[model samples]
Target: MSSEPTHQNIHTFDQATALQPAGPHHWKGQPGRLYWNMVGPFGGTTAATLLHAVLLHPERIGEPAALTVNYAAPLADLPFVLEARPLRTNRSSQHWLLLMTQVDTEGQTITVASGTAVTALRRGTWAGSELPHPPVTPAENLSPRPPTAGLAWSERYDLRLLDGDLPTAWDGAHADDSLTRLWIQDLPPRPIDFLSLAAMSDMFYPRIWRRRALRTPAGTVSMTVYFHADQAALAAAGSGPLLGEARGQEYRHGFFDQRAQLWSADGTIMTTTHQLVYFRD
Candidate 1:
């Protein structure tokens, strides 16, 4: 929506960090919103994750800040290859756009997903204010709690709770306002940047639905991403943690309304996401 620029983001952005490196995890199977619903896919959260990953490092773009992601959505079963390039370089900030789509080969692309991120030129140093960083602890300090005891979506990523007694599989703890803190990171061959975070956010519906005692299993309706600032409080504590938070809501019987707030290591509001989810079961 906005093609404006700002100061450099404190986070790191690298072309190398654009996509998760080689790994066993990837989209491959039934092309349906059902899978997207199961993983909380497409929607606003997906673009937010990808944009955040690239903008984290402002120096790469001559130090620009990321504002938000709009006008696009994610897919459930489409193969995608994300390629980003500098659109133009100005005295203030550098502009960039990332082209995402289903790929048939290293050189072939089909329209699937796409987005744009803008950052400003860094002018000075200042301490910023962040929404109350959740009270959750580091992932390594606690035991790994499973989001779903017997679901395929839950097993895809490396997850750890960051706060108040880990959530249980049968707590009936569904409340639209209750926020859960967790470190969602990718393991193995993947470098695990924002892309991994996007993939992980897709699965949050089940946990929220479970707590609220709601059932969902299909359709990805819509999403919006708003990123304010980046801090270090949400990153890994040592070598095994990547901090982040997701907040969303559910509406009607088949529609899911949601909002997400992502933080940094030193308590910065990395980004915010809004999305609509549809259930299948």
Candidate 2:
């Protein structure tokens, strides 16, 4: 159990209707179930909110390398709050804990999800050599449009689809289920940080599931994110916006597979992701 001055300080609130991540994001009343649109905890739930506690502090060093997330449950329409606490802080590395819960008018905290992360400080390997050279649109020529369909987060990033159909997640184009290319750069340069890459990786979820029923939404039990390599380093080398080819789809088995290549600007295969997705549709 790592201890800090504000280790127990949990900032919780109902995420607003828009699922916005600012002051007081909570639920409304009635049928419960968070809202018509609630933020997916993974991508939207960047450990930043949790790290804010420490990164805001003066003595923190290095960036996080590993982050793990597990769904606590379906959040309903109620007052909710989330906070990150440091579980362990040592000389070479750190571990952080995350929790989000629902609170009622009577002031009760129902635990939603608990997550952990391991971060370290060290220069990464691979200096942009040995990776595949992906096509580049350059920030100047990249034109990302708002996702008039699908989830809210998709619209925020100007994504240029490498092969998927249009500004919707439910496109009926399962012919090849090819590699997707999106010009993923934050507004005015959020700068290449660990947080941004984590968020982008979440976008690959729906893309991986664009099979079986491209025109429908699939029920996801719970998805996990594993950061195997550095996306920024790969991007700077211009290897990606790479290709994440959908490898398999088994509707009868309630699963799918997405195999992607993390190439470098010079055309080196940096890393690979073989994602498995489940659907109830």
- Which candidate number maximizes TM-score? 2
**Tens digit per residue, CA lDDT, model 2, 36-87:** 2344443333333333333443345556555554445555544456555566
How far residue 256's Cα lies from its native spot in candidate 2, in Å, is 4.0
Off by over 4 Å in 2: 1-42, 45-61, 74-79, 88-91, 104-108, 124-131, 136-139, 149-151, 166-178, 219-252, 255-276
- How many backbone clashes does every candidate have? 39, 27
Q: Against the unseen true structure, what C-alpha lDDT does each candidate score?
A: 0.46, 0.44
Q: What does the lDDT read for residue 101 in candidate 2?
A: 68
Writing each residue's lDDT as its tens digit, candidate 1 over 217-281 gives 44445444443532332243222244566555555676656666655445555556666666554
